[model samples]
Target chain A: MRTIAFAVALALAAGLPAAAFAQDEGPSTAEVDAVIEAAFPGLDEEWAARLAPDETMEQCNASANVPSDAVFEEIRARAAGTIVYPDDGVLVGSWENGEKLAQSGYGMRFSDYPPRRENGGNCYACHQLTPQEVSYGTLGPSLMGYGKLRDYSEEAVKAAYEKVYNPHMAFPCSMMPRFGTNGVLTIDQIKDIVALLMDPASPVNR
Target chain B: MQKLMTRKISTVALAGALAAGLALAAAAPPAGAQTDEETQRGLERFRQMLREDPWANPALLDADRGELLWTTAAGPKNATLEDCDLGLGPGVVDGAFAQLPRYFEDAGRVMDVETRILWCMQELQGVDVAAYVKRPHPSGGQPVKDVGAIATWVANRSEGEPFAPVLDDAAGRATVAMGEALFNRRSGPFDFSCATCHSASGQRIRLQELPHLSQPEEAQVAIAEWPAYRVSSTHVMTMQHRMYDCYWQMRMPQLEMGSEASVALIAYLVDKAAGGEIAAPGIKR
Candidate 1:
């Protein structure tokens, strides 16, 4: 599949007039879409709504996730609009729960259901939180010294909270989940996650 | 009329064709003769062993239960997981076990199937998973009794498929690259990343051979088998949970599940095993 795709891409890049390579068919959007759509045989209206592309998804799809500056700005602006900060403005919560949440990759799976269930941050899935947890991921930057490096300033702390709440607020097309904005987590949960990342006493800071 | 015309014009751009081309390339099989290769034979043998040698493979029982749990719905929503997105689409568990560790902008990081499912459970189904997220996967020398059953069920859906991540996009590339760098970046008392053991071409810890996840075959073998049932622990563990345990073994602070770094590492592994087959719900130590 890789070879064929590359060959087709090369053909298209070479300006094969679209007719030459047209004979050599590839996986079409419609085809992939059909396969994807068939996967969900019976979905409710709410569940089905998630199947289609949203605004951010459309932009990522159109640009192949390598959007230009203008598109980046647009995505960021749109994602930012989706962010809803806590009404109380307190972004800091207990670091202990945050620590547990960071370490855990549980919750939010098919097994965790019946809805109305409290969600977890599962931050450690893609990051090294503290010096103690050795089984961390290296997909994102090592935040071991997040607070120590930044002096744990009020702004940085708040920003960390919001970033976890909605990573798009910082990096427009971040791979991080919008914990707060998408309702994956609540204001208190966000605060706890921030504490896990930024509190000096927290293992992350140590 | 103008709006419709503009939409038509934009849709006709050559870029979409190019993007589609790239996506197709990203979806292709690996370079070598992966088609001719028979990696699944070993897995099949292992599976056969499970039935013949009960002592050798206790996970078989856990996996059987997992299969049942998968079809059963016990959550507050009282809805079975007939529909769940595993990157490819909803309920499309086939071939998805290996494609994860891909980028998901909604989460602002890369996510394996497990973490992504966790998000779906919370947002779509309204499951309060706060408590489980706090407790570790049950693994105290007994079979992981709780989640392992469900993990076995979900992982069993995509057995003997190819391992591929959708890292064709820049975000995907960046995520994998970040994961690579993190794998090499050492810190803490031991000053180790994932590379300390799994990076070297041929390294091992005690009895197990630690495959070099940076390379192809080894990466595929390691990443393809996850969300497995651990006989000794008697627990089912997702890759995310496995990673947490690994960190604990390293004596480092626990990593946050579904964090940017975790997703990035997943992307790195998936990218490394780009062409390998997907074989989940395997029996583990």
Candidate 2:
């Protein structure tokens, strides 16, 4: 019995039972929802609504972050439908302004309520574009020399713009956030981030 | 907003703390591959410092205050929490934490130590303590909530014992199942579940190492030391605060204190840590 218990412990530590137990004896969506509702009492309705998983999230959750090919395609399509491009045809903005946005990790938190200033992209939290900043996370790829690598083409700039706005459009179930679709970043903010990535003169390319 | 500590915590002192913390990393082996030579050596030196002098650490201040909080009569009921039971029978704190996250008959659910404390506060003191639920987490050397301090003291009781939560019955099974699903469920604007950063072993974000909570061995070591005093924030953070902080980072709404979902998640994580040694009031960075 002790050996069996040890084996179970070992399996859990190695993440071997992740798939099998993910499907077994799990609570239904409704049951989970009930628990969530009971979990947060003081949250305003606007904030509480975020706790509920939409169709996209529901599919993603059911599959354990790796949906089937059909579901993956559907998620991309559904997420794509939510994208709202900038009113003007311009895809890139000032890299200088974008640099500041990239460094900040403000907004979206409950503490930032009542609106103090413009929201930040918090880009540096996950990616390292500039060599000067030693403290940066490796959750996302380093886009250093981004424009230089792509030959600074117009099409590459457009792709960069879209990628910043909605990372899921390019890679489904990607660790990157849906900045544009979730309204975490404005069209202007995203355009500026694109400039940071696509402008050869920008630090990312330098 | 960043609280400007007038005296910027010196880089040299923080470096020393980091070296000490690295000692803890090597003392416990990871459940998966984590072959980093530099970290291992640093961890060895760090443990040496702890062995030299455990009393110099500051977390003991919180534990000191917590001991007083346990016996003192306060709240609306004008009563102390000393009579409260922690599943080792009424008023029996000895080895109670080691066997917690168990099914409580009165509550009809599985609850971890933090949730049990909240229950005792409400029942024995009539404190209406729910008013402070979901308040912003204290940081940057700010004062922590009472829950953090009390948890530190309670967890200190089983400092060396292995976890042994009771989970043989149906209610225990049901709560753990709910928590397991909750941990994996993707929701909110970010589409992030707890598994996004933690399910995988040997992964990290920036300098911080991420443990895979899905595995029992890893879960046992990681979760066993909550109500930890973080060097970066300089606050003793309880498990409830950790849940709140994670949800906030995902841009999800606040997790209500002592809520079923919170308790359920704790139940799942604590059960995963079974057989690991307890080392509460743990110092963190």
Candidate 3:
């Protein structure tokens, strides 16, 4: 309790003085380097490298999550580089299974080590995918009538797939997890999630 | 952290014990021989079971947290919040929660519990409530601690209390009207409204039942409960948080936390659930 109190006091002290905490010629790359390096101390070599802000994260962080169009394009291009299209050109999967994938919010936690349970897209966590879902979190836009509005066009289906694959490809610094790139969900799972958003028969449309 | 852990352990144990007890009490055979009194007792036991595991009974937990958060205090004032009136007299946390979104003459404006808490935090503790809302929880990557706790504590106080928001007052009525409009106004990539899930009864997305918030019983259950403990997120989320989150899911800009829209929504829901019992400090799955 005392330690927490002390930390809070220190935070208050550092935070209360506006001028002291104000930006001074912006954060130096070294400062950014230090913060990023310290953030991942014990991870494996590959994971540790991920701690280093890619060009996208760096620009996003530098601009405080608001990037100019050029910067946004750059981030999108870099993120787009990570995309690996499926061997079969088809992006849409079984909407029935897709609905299940979108609804289930399991996997990705450290406890799911050895990857026992399959990863779920958990799309409903941040969006109201279906009007009837009561358990969803409200972070992203509701996906109800997604197919109805878009006419389930091939372009829209492709866009949804890309958005789910790496949200930064669509909107830079998007809070949505890069389900495909992060290995959190498989390509097939991404297809299912896409189907959930675009399938006419899916509850998302109903 | 130890204290938090201990509290969690005890709460889980208490819930387990209560669930086992209720199961035993409610386990009478489904037979024609059972008397009315026995049946009533069995039903009471089942309700108790529902109470112990509130997440299973979503309505109970929401109001339960609201009641609990009503009394606890954690501003720089270092004082218990028992005296901060909710339209009603000091420490009167009963029907006050339900009747709120009503005009408070002292505050001279209509406010719901979340906004009300923001008011108290500002007035009593000198905390910059707005700043707190703008920044994510002070402990990033960790659970939000104080604000949610305070919110839940206050909410828990009026569990079983009836909802009676003062709709006659100009401001109160205006808030309700605005909330009603917002409930149906859909503006997102998908363009969904609250009506999509809760406007009708008997709607189930999958396994979960979407309660009709328009009905008094359903409304009462929802408005009276909240600031619920969500098992998936493992965070005790406040109603304001819930509302903003809902907006996010709708793919809309986050509601300015504790803004008019948020409070008005609360008023509308609470008004809908006028006569239901208040239950606070609800546990959820």
Candidate 4:
């Protein structure tokens, strides 16, 4: 008794239709590791290492990114522990450099391998920072006048840095990737991005 | 700074629009006195309209070709795939697509639709496994591989069945687990995993709507509609090809066809799409 016809169906779903998704049980890490080795034939050592998950990722997969409150807290706390602050106390960098970082959508993709220019933060992919760009994405809250909204407070700038570093530190299971944690951008690059968000003269605060 | 950025942005947009307009004028004659943007918008709308009417889609022809390939004898042995087993039974194709990436004792591993076809090619038709493994995928207007045709036809047979694979088994569950891990694993220079693009809802790269595959409902819709014919590519693309294309766009090394990694990824998607109705040979932009 199938209801809700599928979109352009070829035939059916899987063989059985108990219709209950397997939520309680999932594949074990060992099971996953063996499969990874097989699926990606001749994988490089670096790529193979990435396939293995840390505590947060394992827990996230187990829960399908919807963990219990206790599990959520554990994931967030573990993620926060991984964050490393910059050696220099100064939180902001040249907004000019920051603006360029924001504009760029390069770095980390396989095509950029062997290292071209410095890695760009690719901030505009998700956030609207300046009114001048009509084609900005809306996945993140608009940062138009971000500094003006916060009155350029030191704490606000630091908070911005933390958000960019690892969003899970503040909000668990966030869709945003851990750019700083993942080494997509360096500490200096992150500080410049913060400047883009906090500088009074930056187009973001225009 | 704000004024300068705005001026620069507007100038860039205007310049791009002018170039596009010139290109379109050279490429196609306007039906009326419509601007290039308006004509482009109309073409986009027509693509959407064709999606609503299956008769308008050119993909159905490929699906038809796939059906003929299934029964027709192919390869060195000149044997019809009637003897090939899809784990349903020998030559039993009905509802087979929905229960794929399962462990087969003969193959000694898990196999998806594409991999199983490769198995049959070697076992039944006596073709050299190296040939298909060495062959590269063809793009636009090129004759698609036999596997693509066969996958489309097989998927077509199970169109109405709800997806519910047996993950309770040892090898099957392990493969699914590997799939889940790979889906979340971030590699390449961009630091992206599939989750970066699909974990969240209401996300898009440019104009394309990215379905969040982690959510069960979304997973059901997204996974089922794959192995589709794309208007953009002008060729029928299978689920494996879709995965291959994604990795390519991610700037990662190409995923080998019928490889363990590819099969594991399919197993993971099938498990996620459990209880979802089958939808294949779908039309896509």
Candidate 5:
């Protein structure tokens, strides 16, 4: 066991890809799950469920976020099914409210428990939505002139709504959160974010 | 030399300006745009200035307190940790921090600095280990616990030493493997693994850069700076606290302090950070 472990470490140190490590050599999935369970003792059911991986998360973890073609399609389909459109069929809402949601990263964290206010898209955390927001992060691509570049068509508006709702619907293994599907953002909030992206009057197009 | 001094002075002035700009940016909504490159450069310069001035770091006060805790006899057995073995026989502290998270024969498990310290506190001083484990990390403006302070002082002793943790033993290797697995495994409501934010190079969460832990160059710099003084929180954060907080932010359940899982992750990180210089109790934003 010592020799094998040493060899595994040696292989890892020799520039072998992490994905190449033999799955059996590492702690089994059950072992890791047990560790996680024991780590967070006495957590309520709601928070406990958050710790366990959903089917989509399990698949993502199993493949290290690089799913096979079949699994990728399945994840996308599952994500698409979870998207709930607004009752009024309005894909766009007030961009002003959307701007606040994008700017505020105020939901779902442990400190945010017994939430004081509505959830946010936390859009600026990843994307550059407006040219004036210099403090934006570079995790996602710049969305400056998003609607303007797309000509603010009806199709563009609907597509923006879907992307904000569940980025996995279009791009599996996307780094963006599943805002609408995961209940981090409501349908109306998602619409507002879409407006922030696709509204002609929004600063993003300016 | 004169030109260099002039340039440094100008850079300091620029950093101050950018800091003020950042404060205003935080207070108001989007207005005038500063390019990402410029903002990052200014932040880096600010960090460098803080690092250069050792006196500016508030963590040193905690390190002094830790030294006091280490020498003074207090617990039930009325023992000082002066004779505690940190993988270098009893009473040896210099350079020990850089070579830790290794397999300990006596304990029969791989232990990091904090875990080993807790063990000694239990055995030598007859302190209740469970109590320390159960205590919550101090919030902003609050001092770190005794263990954290001691960890800071211990880590500070290894300043400028290269990290050379030898994970050649069977237990050590297994722990590293477990850590590697845990780092990559995506769980939780956000579907995040450590890899989610960390595997990629040059990624950020709202202007804060995330290191690519899998890559050695990035891993080295990242791990070497731990037991850092967080400017945002106004406190010295130990590695254990850092791990616990990351789990919290990931929306995972609380990661119990000194758990086997936490040890494994640190072991993996230390292994990856081999040869990185220890600059513990380092300052950070």
Candidate 6:
């Protein structure tokens, strides 16, 4: 039986197109989806929804995070539509609160269910925000002296808010979470993070 | 996030204490102002020190326990796992782990180390697989599960042996193909696949370097280290547990223990890690 299986595998490999060996020939999307669903048997409807990729995520996955130009524009536009600015039209909040939020890496995890406190932007996890924080990730670019580097411009501040609100709006397929659009952070919370990046008084600008 | 939170708090406290101590001693640059290179060098030194003293790894204790479990009889059949086949023939163990996640003819599927062990326990010892699968992983500072311990022991036996998974059969190829697709398939709230964090080299999440698993060199080095002793959790974590935890962190629902998806991911990793030397029970920060 093992010999037969090996012979068949060899024949399959020899006869099939190169694409067959590529990701295209792997389990079908429906099959992979079924496997994911089966892996988490007792998940609630809300949580189960997360297992299924959103339309943008599907495009990103299909393209290996490099969607076609048309699809890219579609994702960016869709993401832009999800951004909800605060009623006050003020993009920046207290730098102090922003600093605190940047420092906290809490919420959205399974253990953070029935959250005891607010969700954090977890900025330091992927970016160098403040010079004082030596231990920061290098996934994203350093944001040190962010506002100061940009001369604390109003345009920079608004841009910071939009990026945080939905990173895909600015750069589609960015690894950063969609904090505001995904409901991981409140509109006010996003304002605070914008303050962290664009507030002249914030340590990031120091 | 809880882990990251704890780390953040401790880091702040450590920086403050260092600042005070340095002020009393002599002038210093600033508190927590060490450059990224300096931090990376410090962590590398710490890891090197740990590696130099192989006996210092706490995962060995779990491996010792696993050895005991392997020899003892306890299940309904009251049979030891001596007769178990781990891709090698029954009762064979030496260098067995390095070539696993292979196609098992009897099982008619591809299974990684932990899944294969579960199969053995059920078939040979009449163990209740469901009950075993449902057992929760140990919390912080607690000991790993018996299966995890067992996997550590088995994998340790293959230490220094190069990974040589033979995915030449139809089942093996199919499983690995699924694994490759899954690794890049983005899902969940954060739009993350395993590739999101790991596809790129030299990237990090809070000072933790993300390995580009798509690259053979990085994949080999990374995969070779598991069943590792996680310093934060203070326990030996098996590959299955690692998958479960990662999915949890990705905000996805729990990945069932020894599930096909879990096995496929491992198979994919093992294939990527081919020719990489086994360094089981390696220390992790």
Candidate 3, residues B215-260, lDDT tens digits: the string is 8877766655576655446456667777766655543444555666
Give the root-mean-square deviation of each candidate in angstroms. Answer: 21.3, 10.5, 15.4, 12.7, 7.4, 8.5
Best by DockQ: 6
Q: What TM value does model 5 have? A: 0.86
DockQ scores for all predicted structures: 0.01, 0.32, 0.02, 0.19, 0.43, 0.46
Poorest stretch of ten by lDDT in candidate 5 chain B? B3-12
- Model 5 per-residue lDDT at B101: 90
Per-residue lDDT of model 5, residues B39-72, tens digit only: 5776577678767875445676677788889999
By TM-score, rank the candidates, best first: 6, 5, 2, 4, 3, 1
The fraction of reference interface contacts (C-alpha pairs within 8 A across chains A and B) present in each candidate is 0.00, 0.61, 0.00, 0.28, 0.66, 0.74
Error of 3 at A138 (Å): 20
RMSD of 5: 7.4
Deviation from truth (RMSD, Å), model 6: 8.5
Per-residue CA lDDT of model 4 for A44-151, tens digit only, reads 777655555556666665565678999989978877887778887888888889989887877655456788888787677778788765555666677889988999
TM-score of 1: 0.46
Please give, for every candidate in the order listed, the TM-score of chain B alone compared with the true chain B: 0.71, 0.81, 0.71, 0.83, 0.85, 0.85
Query: What TM-score against the true fold does each predicted structure earn?
Result: 0.46, 0.82, 0.50, 0.71, 0.86, 0.87
Interface CA RMSD, all predictions? 16.1, 3.4, 15.1, 4.2, 2.4, 2.4
Positional deviation of residue A35's Cα in model 3 after best superposition, in angstroms: 38
**Model 6 lDDT at residue B252:** 78
User: How many clashes would you count in candidate 5?
Assistant: 0
**Backbone collisions counted per model:** 72, 5, 44, 21, 0, 0
Per-residue C-alpha lDDT of model 4 across residues B189-252, encoded as one tens digit per residue: 4445787788788875533568888788888988887677676676778888888878865546
Looking at candidate 6 chain A, the ten consecutive residues that score lowest on lDDT are A15-24
